[model samples]
Target: MLQLPHQSLQVAAVPAQRTAAREDQDGPWHTEAVCRRDEAGLFFAPSKEPTAARLSREDAAKRVCARCPVMVECREHALLQPEPYGVWGGLTAAERRVVLARRRRREMELKKSASAA
Candidate 1:
């Protein structure tokens, strides 16, 4: 895991689209901040494939998420956008579904409590 510098929590502002000089896909902003990488024999490299499958990619993401600083924000974005592909917020699609279910459950519980009170 990369030890981020000690600075205030600043949300990374990813441009909706990349600049002409730098294509959206060919920049640190796309991969470094948004994707997980694995530490190989002696180097850290991004995952070869961006798509997620059953276990391999999930395992890789779990390791990267163990140290990601903006995991919360990432997950929130993924949930809100209903991203159909790739790993986001350190969670796979199925995991995000579980999270959404839990969140909805909690919201219902809160509403019930408020009504009873």
Candidate 2:
């Protein structure tokens, strides 16, 4: 019997904070996130969070994101997944919602204009 060379399929450990797939290039980027090494709680809002506190926490999270090498990638991933909570890629959940809403409105306007033309 001869053993041929083969690639081993090893599963990477998933962190508790991970809420998205990590199979893509985004995985490495996410691993480099400053949030990963810092207090995870800071990236997420507490229950019954006040608007002011949410804003302040989000600002602090964004500051960390500012120095992250993969900030853009992380942000794009968050926007695409439309992550429901936490400060991801420097954006709060509310901000991602706003962006989604704007994109939807833009698409509708474009469709309406195209149909009218």
Candidate 3:
């Protein structure tokens, strides 16, 4: 996996606080799936929200993802499966939907162009 120079620097300079947040296990919901595996299997599950927060603790997740060496792998995984919950690979569910939609549209356009040719 070739990382861009900026990406290497980003990983190297990640804040310690962000790294520790990924290890926190006492959140109302278990977001461990966001980082534990290469696949986005458990990320789509519904879980209890923390009493004090309206949004899930996905901001911390985005931070951890920023430093992930396998961010491309994780994005590809989310794209393949279309995980419907939580943030992954620097994208929220809504963002991933847009990405997948664009990808499909591009593929369709390519196929149409090929057929016309």
lDDT of each: 0.51, 0.68, 0.52
Clashes of each: 0, 0, 0
| Candidate 1, 1-117: lDDT as tens digits | 332234112122322422123223444333544343433211122344333322553565566665666556566667876664445667767778888889999999999999999
Instruction: Estimate the Cα RMSD of every predicted model relative to the unseen true structure.
Output: 12.3, 14.0, 14.3
Sorting all predicted structures by TM-score, with the top scorer first, yields 2, 3, 1
Q: To one decimal, what is the Cα RMSD in angstroms of model 2 from the true structure?
A: 14.0
Better of 2 and 3 by lDDT: 2
What are the runs in model 1 whose C-alpha is more than 4 Å off? 1-53
TM-score of each candidate structure, all chains considered together: 0.53, 0.68, 0.53
Clashing pairs in 3: none
Model 1 per-residue lDDT at 33: 46
lDDT value, residue 82 of candidate 2: 65
lDDT pick, better of 1 and 2: 2
**Which of the predicted structures, 2 or 3, would earn the higher TM-score when compared with the native?**
2
lDDT of 2 by residue, 4-79 (tens): 1241122223235545455564455677777778445667665676776556666777888888887887887788
State how far residue 22 of model 3 sits from its true place (Å).
24
Candidate 3: global Cα-lDDT? 0.52
At residue 107, give the lDDT of candidate 3. Answer: 99
